[model samples]
Target: MALYQQVTGLEPHPKSDGDFTGLNREDGLVIGFQRVDGYPAPRWPDHRSPTASHLLQGQRGPGGSRGRLLELGAGKPDHQPHELARARVLTDPAGHPFCIVRG
Candidate 1:
Protein backbone atom coordinates (compact mmCIF):
# COMPACT_ATOMS: atom_id res chain seq x y z
CA MET A 1 0.00 0.00 0.00
CA ALA A 2 1.34 3.43 -1.02
CA LEU A 3 0.42 7.01 -0.20
CA TYR A 4 -2.36 7.33 -2.78
CA GLN A 5 -3.70 4.04 -1.61
CA GLN A 6 -3.67 5.16 1.99
CA VAL A 7 -5.37 8.45 1.20
CA THR A 8 -7.69 7.77 -1.76
CA GLY A 9 -8.51 4.25 -0.71
CA LEU A 10 -7.74 3.09 -4.27
CA GLU A 11 -4.89 1.25 -5.96
CA PRO A 12 -3.78 3.80 -8.51
CA HIS A 13 -1.31 2.63 -11.11
CA PRO A 14 2.20 3.94 -11.13
CA LYS A 15 3.25 5.76 -14.36
CA SER A 16 -0.29 5.59 -15.63
CA ASP A 17 -1.68 8.93 -16.71
CA GLY A 18 -4.40 9.67 -14.22
CA ASP A 19 -6.94 12.40 -13.76
CA PHE A 20 -7.33 12.92 -10.02
CA THR A 21 -10.45 14.99 -10.70
CA GLY A 22 -12.32 11.70 -10.92
CA LEU A 23 -11.27 10.84 -7.40
CA ASN A 24 -13.26 13.83 -6.16
CA ARG A 25 -15.61 14.84 -8.96
CA GLU A 26 -17.39 17.85 -7.55
CA ASP A 27 -14.04 19.46 -6.84
CA GLY A 28 -13.35 19.99 -10.58
CA LEU A 29 -9.60 19.59 -10.84
CA VAL A 30 -6.86 18.73 -13.34
CA ILE A 31 -3.22 17.77 -12.74
CA GLY A 32 -0.43 18.56 -15.18
CA PHE A 33 2.97 20.07 -15.68
CA GLN A 34 2.70 23.72 -16.57
CA ARG A 35 5.61 24.99 -18.71
CA VAL A 36 6.81 27.68 -16.37
CA ASP A 37 10.13 28.23 -14.65
CA GLY A 38 11.43 29.08 -11.18
CA TYR A 39 8.53 27.61 -9.22
CA PRO A 40 8.07 24.09 -7.88
CA ALA A 41 4.97 22.35 -9.20
CA PRO A 42 3.13 20.13 -6.79
CA ARG A 43 2.97 16.35 -6.98
CA TRP A 44 0.32 13.87 -5.78
CA PRO A 45 -2.85 15.15 -4.10
CA ASP A 46 -2.07 18.78 -4.85
CA HIS A 47 -5.40 20.43 -5.54
CA ARG A 48 -5.86 22.00 -8.96
CA SER A 49 -9.14 23.57 -9.98
CA PRO A 50 -9.85 23.17 -13.68
CA THR A 51 -9.58 26.20 -15.97
CA ALA A 52 -13.27 25.79 -16.68
CA SER A 53 -14.00 26.63 -13.07
CA HIS A 54 -12.99 30.16 -13.85
CA LEU A 55 -14.04 30.41 -17.51
CA LEU A 56 -17.47 28.93 -16.94
CA GLN A 57 -18.12 29.43 -13.25
CA GLY A 58 -16.43 32.76 -12.60
CA GLN A 59 -16.93 36.15 -14.22
CA ARG A 60 -14.27 37.42 -16.65
CA GLY A 61 -14.58 40.54 -18.76
CA PRO A 62 -12.78 41.80 -21.87
CA GLY A 63 -9.78 42.99 -19.89
CA GLY A 64 -10.06 40.65 -17.00
CA SER A 65 -7.55 37.92 -16.27
CA ARG A 66 -8.08 34.23 -16.77
CA GLY A 67 -8.21 31.50 -14.14
CA ARG A 68 -8.57 31.54 -10.39
CA LEU A 69 -6.27 29.91 -7.87
CA LEU A 70 -7.24 29.29 -4.30
CA GLU A 71 -5.82 27.44 -1.34
CA LEU A 72 -8.71 25.52 0.22
CA GLY A 73 -7.28 25.73 3.69
CA ALA A 74 -7.51 29.29 4.82
CA GLY A 75 -8.60 30.92 8.03
CA LYS A 76 -10.23 34.20 8.92
CA PRO A 77 -8.53 36.40 11.46
CA ASP A 78 -11.23 35.67 14.01
CA HIS A 79 -10.71 31.95 13.60
CA GLN A 80 -7.56 30.21 14.72
CA PRO A 81 -6.31 26.72 14.08
CA HIS A 82 -8.09 24.37 16.43
CA GLU A 83 -5.92 21.40 15.49
CA LEU A 84 -2.39 22.75 15.04
CA ALA A 85 -0.71 25.22 17.34
CA ARG A 86 1.25 27.13 14.68
CA ALA A 87 -1.98 29.04 13.89
CA ARG A 88 -0.75 30.36 10.51
CA VAL A 89 1.16 27.55 8.87
CA LEU A 90 -0.98 26.57 5.89
CA THR A 91 -0.59 22.87 5.32
CA ASP A 92 -1.37 21.31 1.97
CA PRO A 93 -4.18 18.84 1.65
CA ALA A 94 -2.59 15.39 1.97
CA GLY A 95 0.71 17.17 2.62
CA HIS A 96 1.32 17.88 -1.08
CA PRO A 97 3.14 21.00 -2.25
CA PHE A 98 2.09 23.45 -5.01
CA CYS A 99 3.43 26.32 -7.10
CA ILE A 100 1.94 29.13 -9.21
CA VAL A 101 3.37 30.30 -12.54
CA ARG A 102 2.73 33.36 -14.70
CA GLY A 103 2.97 33.51 -18.44
Candidate 2:
Protein backbone atom coordinates (compact mmCIF):
# COMPACT_ATOMS: atom_id res chain seq x y z
CA MET A 1 0.00 0.00 0.00
CA ALA A 2 2.84 2.36 0.82
CA LEU A 3 4.42 1.66 -2.54
CA TYR A 4 1.16 2.31 -4.35
CA GLN A 5 0.62 5.55 -2.50
CA GLN A 6 4.13 6.70 -3.33
CA VAL A 7 3.94 5.71 -6.96
CA THR A 8 0.42 6.89 -7.76
CA GLY A 9 0.04 9.55 -5.10
CA LEU A 10 -3.31 8.04 -4.27
CA GLU A 11 -4.80 7.19 -0.92
CA PRO A 12 -4.74 3.70 0.48
CA HIS A 13 -7.42 1.71 -1.28
CA PRO A 14 -9.93 0.07 0.95
CA LYS A 15 -10.07 -3.70 0.87
CA SER A 16 -12.99 -6.03 1.23
CA ASP A 17 -13.12 -8.97 3.53
CA GLY A 18 -14.15 -11.17 0.68
CA ASP A 19 -12.00 -13.95 -0.70
CA PHE A 20 -9.74 -11.58 -2.57
CA THR A 21 -5.99 -12.03 -3.03
CA GLY A 22 -2.87 -10.85 -4.82
CA LEU A 23 -0.31 -12.43 -7.12
CA ASN A 24 3.48 -12.27 -7.03
CA ARG A 25 5.07 -12.80 -10.39
CA GLU A 26 8.68 -12.80 -11.47
CA ASP A 27 8.07 -9.45 -13.13
CA GLY A 28 6.38 -7.67 -10.24
CA LEU A 29 3.42 -7.61 -7.91
CA VAL A 30 -0.20 -7.47 -9.07
CA ILE A 31 -2.60 -5.63 -6.78
CA GLY A 32 -6.35 -5.96 -7.09
CA PHE A 33 -8.81 -3.16 -6.44
CA GLN A 34 -12.56 -3.39 -6.49
CA ARG A 35 -14.47 -0.27 -7.33
CA VAL A 36 -17.80 0.85 -6.01
CA ASP A 37 -19.09 0.70 -9.54
CA GLY A 38 -18.64 -3.06 -9.47
CA TYR A 39 -15.41 -3.40 -11.39
CA PRO A 40 -11.86 -4.46 -10.69
CA ALA A 41 -8.80 -2.45 -11.61
CA PRO A 42 -5.08 -3.06 -11.19
CA ARG A 43 -2.25 -0.62 -10.56
CA TRP A 44 1.12 -0.89 -12.28
CA PRO A 45 3.97 1.31 -13.36
CA ASP A 46 3.61 3.33 -16.57
CA HIS A 47 6.19 1.37 -18.52
CA ARG A 48 4.00 1.21 -21.59
CA SER A 49 5.23 4.47 -23.02
CA PRO A 50 8.28 4.41 -25.30
CA THR A 51 10.00 7.28 -23.52
CA ALA A 52 9.72 5.43 -20.25
CA SER A 53 11.72 2.53 -21.66
CA HIS A 54 14.60 4.76 -22.68
CA LEU A 55 14.80 6.26 -19.21
CA LEU A 56 14.82 2.83 -17.66
CA GLN A 57 17.64 1.60 -19.88
CA GLY A 58 19.80 4.55 -18.94
CA GLN A 59 19.41 3.83 -15.25
CA ARG A 60 20.44 0.20 -15.65
CA GLY A 61 24.17 -0.52 -15.51
CA PRO A 62 26.05 -1.47 -18.66
CA GLY A 63 26.03 -4.93 -20.25
CA GLY A 64 22.37 -5.45 -19.51
CA SER A 65 19.68 -6.65 -21.86
CA ARG A 66 20.01 -4.56 -24.99
CA GLY A 67 17.77 -4.56 -28.02
CA ARG A 68 14.85 -2.78 -29.61
CA LEU A 69 11.43 -4.28 -29.07
CA LEU A 70 7.78 -3.40 -29.55
CA GLU A 71 5.39 -2.88 -26.67
CA LEU A 72 1.81 -3.58 -27.67
CA GLY A 73 -0.51 -1.13 -26.02
CA ALA A 74 -4.02 -1.98 -24.89
CA GLY A 75 -5.16 -1.36 -28.43
CA LYS A 76 -2.80 1.28 -29.70
CA PRO A 77 0.18 0.91 -32.03
CA ASP A 78 3.20 -0.97 -30.76
CA HIS A 79 5.87 1.31 -29.34
CA GLN A 80 9.40 0.35 -30.32
CA PRO A 81 12.73 0.18 -28.51
CA HIS A 82 11.12 0.00 -25.13
CA GLU A 83 14.12 -1.17 -23.12
CA LEU A 84 11.91 -2.74 -20.52
CA ALA A 85 12.49 -6.38 -21.30
CA ARG A 86 13.68 -6.94 -17.77
CA ALA A 87 10.37 -5.68 -16.46
CA ARG A 88 7.52 -8.01 -15.70
CA VAL A 89 4.09 -8.03 -17.31
CA LEU A 90 1.32 -8.46 -14.80
CA THR A 91 -2.36 -8.94 -15.56
CA ASP A 92 -5.22 -7.75 -13.42
CA PRO A 93 -7.69 -10.00 -11.66
CA ALA A 94 -10.05 -9.56 -14.56
CA GLY A 95 -7.24 -10.26 -17.01
CA HIS A 96 -6.54 -6.58 -17.63
CA PRO A 97 -3.06 -5.60 -18.77
CA PHE A 98 -0.43 -4.06 -16.53
CA CYS A 99 3.37 -3.96 -16.36
CA ILE A 100 6.02 -3.24 -13.73
CA VAL A 101 9.31 -2.80 -15.54
CA ARG A 102 12.12 -0.81 -13.99
CA GLY A 103 15.80 -0.44 -14.62
Candidate 3:
Protein backbone atom coordinates (compact mmCIF):
# COMPACT_ATOMS: atom_id res chain seq x y z
CA MET A 1 0.00 0.00 0.00
CA ALA A 2 2.82 2.36 0.76
CA LEU A 3 4.35 1.90 -2.70
CA TYR A 4 0.94 2.19 -4.33
CA GLN A 5 0.20 5.40 -2.50
CA GLN A 6 3.51 6.90 -3.62
CA VAL A 7 3.14 5.93 -7.25
CA THR A 8 -0.54 6.69 -7.79
CA GLY A 9 -0.80 9.76 -5.56
CA LEU A 10 -4.13 8.37 -4.43
CA GLU A 11 -5.25 7.38 -0.99
CA PRO A 12 -6.14 3.90 0.06
CA HIS A 13 -9.89 3.54 -0.06
CA PRO A 14 -11.65 3.77 3.29
CA LYS A 15 -13.40 0.52 2.50
CA SER A 16 -10.12 -1.38 2.13
CA ASP A 17 -9.97 -4.15 4.70
CA GLY A 18 -7.41 -6.62 5.97
CA ASP A 19 -5.56 -8.56 3.27
CA PHE A 20 -7.13 -6.34 0.63
CA THR A 21 -6.25 -2.79 -0.38
CA GLY A 22 -7.83 -0.58 -2.99
CA LEU A 23 -7.62 2.87 -4.54
CA ASN A 24 -10.91 4.45 -5.43
CA ARG A 25 -11.14 7.82 -7.09
CA GLU A 26 -13.93 9.89 -8.66
CA ASP A 27 -12.82 8.58 -12.05
CA GLY A 28 -14.88 5.52 -11.11
CA LEU A 29 -11.96 3.14 -11.50
CA VAL A 30 -11.27 1.00 -8.47
CA ILE A 31 -7.89 -0.69 -8.21
CA GLY A 32 -7.87 -3.49 -5.72
CA PHE A 33 -5.46 -6.07 -4.31
CA GLN A 34 -6.13 -9.19 -2.31
CA ARG A 35 -3.30 -10.95 -0.54
CA VAL A 36 -2.62 -14.53 -1.41
CA ASP A 37 -0.24 -16.84 0.43
CA GLY A 38 2.92 -17.90 -1.43
CA TYR A 39 1.93 -16.41 -4.72
CA PRO A 40 4.74 -16.44 -7.28
CA ALA A 41 5.71 -13.20 -8.92
CA PRO A 42 5.13 -13.41 -12.66
CA ARG A 43 8.04 -13.50 -15.09
CA TRP A 44 7.79 -10.86 -17.75
CA PRO A 45 8.02 -12.17 -21.35
CA ASP A 46 8.17 -15.69 -20.02
CA HIS A 47 4.84 -17.19 -20.92
CA ARG A 48 5.70 -20.68 -19.78
CA SER A 49 5.87 -19.55 -16.19
CA PRO A 50 3.04 -17.92 -14.31
CA THR A 51 2.59 -14.51 -15.90
CA ALA A 52 1.10 -11.23 -14.78
CA SER A 53 -2.61 -10.91 -14.24
CA HIS A 54 -4.28 -7.53 -13.77
CA LEU A 55 -2.39 -4.73 -15.48
CA LEU A 56 -3.22 -1.53 -13.64
CA GLN A 57 -1.73 1.67 -15.01
CA GLY A 58 -1.75 5.39 -14.48
CA GLN A 59 -3.71 7.55 -16.89
CA ARG A 60 -4.38 10.91 -15.26
CA GLY A 61 -1.56 12.00 -12.97
CA PRO A 62 2.14 11.83 -12.17
CA GLY A 63 1.54 8.13 -11.79
CA GLY A 64 1.23 7.99 -15.54
CA SER A 65 4.53 9.65 -16.21
CA ARG A 66 7.64 7.59 -16.89
CA GLY A 67 9.76 9.93 -14.81
CA ARG A 68 7.35 9.83 -11.90
CA LEU A 69 7.14 6.08 -12.01
CA LEU A 70 10.92 5.77 -11.86
CA GLU A 71 11.05 8.24 -8.99
CA LEU A 72 8.67 5.96 -7.16
CA GLY A 73 10.83 2.82 -7.61
CA ALA A 74 9.55 1.49 -10.91
CA GLY A 75 12.17 -0.28 -13.04
CA LYS A 76 12.70 -1.03 -16.70
CA PRO A 77 12.98 -4.57 -17.95
CA ASP A 78 16.30 -5.60 -19.46
CA HIS A 79 14.71 -6.54 -22.77
CA GLN A 80 12.22 -3.93 -23.86
CA PRO A 81 9.80 -4.75 -26.62
CA HIS A 82 10.24 -2.95 -29.93
CA GLU A 83 6.63 -1.83 -29.82
CA LEU A 84 7.29 0.30 -26.75
CA ALA A 85 9.80 2.57 -28.45
CA ARG A 86 7.69 5.67 -28.03
CA ALA A 87 6.57 4.69 -24.55
CA ARG A 88 8.04 2.89 -21.54
CA VAL A 89 7.76 -0.47 -19.85
CA LEU A 90 8.28 -0.41 -16.12
CA THR A 91 8.03 -2.71 -13.16
CA ASP A 92 6.49 -1.76 -9.88
CA PRO A 93 8.19 -2.39 -6.57
CA ALA A 94 6.61 -5.83 -6.74
CA GLY A 95 7.97 -6.57 -10.22
CA HIS A 96 4.62 -6.13 -11.93
CA PRO A 97 4.83 -4.77 -15.46
CA PHE A 98 2.93 -1.64 -16.45
CA CYS A 99 3.30 0.66 -19.39
CA ILE A 100 3.29 4.42 -19.74
CA VAL A 101 2.20 5.64 -23.11
CA ARG A 102 1.44 9.00 -24.60
CA GLY A 103 -2.10 9.85 -25.52
Candidate 4:
Protein backbone atom coordinates (compact mmCIF):
# COMPACT_ATOMS: atom_id res chain seq x y z
CA MET A 1 0.00 0.00 0.00
CA ALA A 2 2.82 2.35 0.78
CA LEU A 3 4.36 1.56 -2.58
CA TYR A 4 1.20 2.56 -4.38
CA GLN A 5 0.84 5.71 -2.34
CA GLN A 6 4.34 6.77 -3.27
CA VAL A 7 3.83 6.00 -6.95
CA THR A 8 0.35 7.47 -7.44
CA GLY A 9 0.29 10.04 -4.67
CA LEU A 10 -3.21 8.96 -3.74
CA GLU A 11 -3.71 8.25 -0.09
CA PRO A 12 -5.74 5.37 1.16
CA HIS A 13 -9.35 6.04 1.95
CA PRO A 14 -10.69 5.54 5.42
CA LYS A 15 -11.08 1.89 6.18
CA SER A 16 -14.57 0.56 6.74
CA ASP A 17 -13.05 -2.59 8.15
CA GLY A 18 -9.55 -3.95 8.59
CA ASP A 19 -10.17 -6.61 5.95
CA PHE A 20 -10.19 -4.09 3.10
CA THR A 21 -7.94 -1.14 2.26
CA GLY A 22 -8.60 1.22 -0.58
CA LEU A 23 -7.68 4.51 -2.22
CA ASN A 24 -9.98 6.95 -3.93
CA ARG A 25 -8.79 9.34 -6.61
CA GLU A 26 -10.38 12.64 -7.52
CA ASP A 27 -11.44 11.17 -10.87
CA GLY A 28 -13.62 8.59 -9.10
CA LEU A 29 -11.10 5.77 -9.49
CA VAL A 30 -11.11 3.65 -6.41
CA ILE A 31 -8.58 0.86 -5.87
CA GLY A 32 -9.45 -1.66 -3.22
CA PHE A 33 -7.30 -4.29 -1.61
CA GLN A 34 -8.57 -7.30 0.29
CA ARG A 35 -7.08 -10.46 1.62
CA VAL A 36 -8.30 -13.79 0.35
CA ASP A 37 -7.00 -16.79 2.17
CA GLY A 38 -4.85 -19.02 -0.07
CA TYR A 39 -5.35 -16.87 -3.14
CA PRO A 40 -2.81 -17.91 -5.78
CA ALA A 41 -0.52 -15.44 -7.46
CA PRO A 42 -1.79 -14.19 -10.80
CA ARG A 43 -0.22 -14.87 -14.19
CA TRP A 44 0.57 -11.81 -16.25
CA PRO A 45 -0.89 -11.32 -19.76
CA ASP A 46 -2.55 -14.67 -19.41
CA HIS A 47 -5.95 -16.30 -19.00
CA ARG A 48 -6.22 -17.04 -15.28
CA SER A 49 -5.30 -13.60 -14.04
CA PRO A 50 -4.96 -10.49 -16.10
CA THR A 51 -4.17 -6.88 -15.50
CA ALA A 52 -6.30 -6.73 -12.36
CA SER A 53 -5.66 -3.03 -12.19
CA HIS A 54 -4.56 -0.41 -14.67
CA LEU A 55 -3.53 3.20 -14.16
CA LEU A 56 -4.47 5.12 -17.23
CA GLN A 57 -2.20 7.76 -18.72
CA GLY A 58 0.84 6.82 -16.73
CA GLN A 59 3.89 8.89 -17.59
CA ARG A 60 6.55 7.30 -19.74
CA GLY A 61 9.24 6.46 -17.27
CA PRO A 62 12.92 7.33 -17.75
CA GLY A 63 15.75 7.09 -15.22
CA GLY A 64 14.64 8.20 -11.73
CA SER A 65 11.34 9.13 -13.31
CA ARG A 66 10.99 5.62 -14.75
CA GLY A 67 8.34 4.71 -12.20
CA ARG A 68 9.82 4.24 -8.78
CA LEU A 69 7.67 1.15 -8.50
CA LEU A 70 10.75 -1.06 -8.74
CA GLU A 71 12.52 0.85 -5.99
CA LEU A 72 9.27 0.76 -4.05
CA GLY A 73 9.07 -3.06 -4.43
CA ALA A 74 7.23 -3.76 -7.66
CA GLY A 75 8.34 -6.68 -9.86
CA LYS A 76 9.21 -6.62 -13.54
CA PRO A 77 8.54 -9.65 -15.69
CA ASP A 78 11.36 -11.01 -17.83
CA HIS A 79 9.36 -10.64 -21.02
CA GLN A 80 6.54 -8.36 -22.09
CA PRO A 81 4.07 -9.23 -24.83
CA HIS A 82 3.72 -7.29 -28.06
CA GLU A 83 0.20 -6.21 -27.31
CA LEU A 84 1.34 -4.11 -24.39
CA ALA A 85 3.60 -1.59 -26.11
CA ARG A 86 1.90 1.42 -24.53
CA ALA A 87 1.34 -0.24 -21.17
CA ARG A 88 4.09 -1.34 -18.85
CA VAL A 89 3.31 -4.56 -17.04
CA LEU A 90 4.45 -4.81 -13.46
CA THR A 91 3.64 -6.71 -10.34
CA ASP A 92 3.29 -5.52 -6.82
CA PRO A 93 5.22 -7.13 -3.99
CA ALA A 94 2.44 -9.72 -3.95
CA GLY A 95 2.71 -10.53 -7.68
CA HIS A 96 -0.49 -9.01 -8.96
CA PRO A 97 -0.18 -7.57 -12.47
CA PHE A 98 -0.74 -3.86 -13.02
CA CYS A 99 -0.52 -1.99 -16.30
CA ILE A 100 0.65 1.58 -16.56
CA VAL A 101 -0.53 2.97 -19.86
CA ARG A 102 1.66 5.63 -21.39
CA GLY A 103 0.13 9.04 -21.14
TM-scores, all models, native as reference? 0.21, 0.24, 0.75, 0.72
Report the alpha-carbon TM-score of model 4 versus the true structure.
0.72
Cand. 2 TM to true fold: 0.24
What's the distance in Å from true for residue 23, model 1?
6.5
Report the error of model 1 at residue 61, Å: 43
Best by TM-score: 3
lDDT of 3 at 49: 57
Report, for every candidate in turn, its global Cα lDDT versus the true structure. Answer: 0.27, 0.33, 0.69, 0.67
Residue range with the least summed lDDT across 10 consecutive positions in model 4: 57-66
Tens-digit lDDT track for model 4 on 3-79? 66777677688763677888778887877887677777777656576445655427544312345777788888866
Candidate 3 TM-score over all chains jointly: 0.75
Over 1-103, each residue of candidate 1 has an lDDT whose tens digit, in order, gives 1322232333333334332222222344322222234435333233462222111111132211212222233112222234343122221333333222222
Ranking by TM-score: 3, 4, 2, 1
Q: Which stretches of candidate 4 lie over 4 Å from their true place?
A: 26-29, 49-57, 60-67
Candidate 1: where is the Cα deviation over 4 Å? Answer: 13-80, 84-103
Cα deviation at 3, candidate 4, in Å, is: 1.9
Global CA lDDT computed for model 4: 0.67
Task: Give me the displacement of residue 34 in model 1, in angstroms.
Answer: 9.2
* Model 2: colliding residue pairs: 27-88
